[model samples]
Target: MFISGVHHIQLTAPPGCEPDARAFYIGLLGLDEIPKPRSLQDRGGVWFRTGNCDLHISPRENDTPPGTNWHVALRVKNAEALRRKLQEAGARIDPAPEIPGWKRFFGYDPFGNKLEFLEIA
Candidate 1:
């Protein structure tokens, strides 16, 4: 019971998809890219800072397939605005069912990773 909080969430992308990954996670999502360790730089991946939690995207030989239920939930301040922005950018967004005191939606990264954005009402 020594755990305090999540330090990071790791996701995987297809090999050689760094540019697209940067665009989706950094440009579209507004996450700031952070420097990875010098030794791991050659592995071909990117790290991003989101509030106190860090998101790590690693390049893998096999990419994730669609229709998977696995997803990462991120708390946000403006889910509506973000949904609009993502829709405008042609990203696939799935509306979530009503939650009593929450606004939420589902989005996918360029690599087909599922992400959830939620705001408390």
Candidate 2:
């Protein structure tokens, strides 16, 4: 039981898509951008601070298959409001089934990465 909690989650983005990634993760999602180390700066990726954890987006070709269920579940304050916001912003929203003690939904980022938003009930 050495692992305590997650420090960061890394996801891939298509090469040369830093602007698009920043637009979505920072402009749309409102995540605070963090500076990357000098050694990694030239790698072409962005890092974000989300609550207690960090999210790293590396520049690479994403080969995820269609309909893949892989996703990062992010805890949110108001799932309904965020769902509407994402919907209004032209992001795809997928309704999720009722789960005990949780209100949740799935949405896709600009990179086609599935993200689950949940609010504890």
Candidate 3:
């Protein structure tokens, strides 16, 4: 099987919550917002870009299932600062920043989507 790199990852959020999603991902985590194609705006969503990875958020028609392990991970220059920014923005820190070969930490978005950051060494 020949497979190229990941094209993009799409995550579902409860309907009409794009603003909050934007606040958390863009306002808090500091990921750059990518403009979605005009054709997709009516569907209600937002896009974020970090290096080659794209994170797409779409409105969920139904409740997100329990125990779903979907998430997006980002690599940053300083995991501790990122974690601090997230904490200051009122995000719940799941795993506090730690240095185990790589400085890292984990947190959840407004809708409980898992997010992690790792410092690039």
Candidate achieving the largest lDDT: 1
Relative to the unseen true structure, what is the C-alpha lDDT of residue 19 in candidate 3, on a scale of 0 to 100? 95
- Looking at candidate 1, the ten consecutive residues that score lowest on lDDT are 61-70
Backbone atom clashes (below 3 Å) for every candidate: 0, 0, 0
lDDT against the true structure, per candidate, is 0.90, 0.88, 0.79
Model 2: runs farther than 4 Å from truth?
65-67
C-alpha-based local distance difference test score of model 3: 0.79
Q: What is the C-alpha lDDT profile of model 3 across 15-109, one tens digit per residue?
A: 89889988887887777899999888998888898678889988887757346355577788877888888888888887745566787777888
Native-to-model Cα distance after best TM-score fit, residue 74 in candidate 2, in Å: 0.2
Can you write out model 1's per-residue Cα lDDT over 1-121, one digit (the tens) per residue?
9999999999999888789888998888899999999999999989999999999989988667546678999998888999999899989999888899999999988888899999998
Give candidate 3 regions above 4 Å deviation.
Answer: 65-70, 96-100
TM-score of each: 0.93, 0.92, 0.84
Model 3, residue 110: distance off in Å is 0.3
* Better by lDDT, candidate 3 or 2: 2
Clashing pairs in 3: none
Candidate topping TM-score: 1
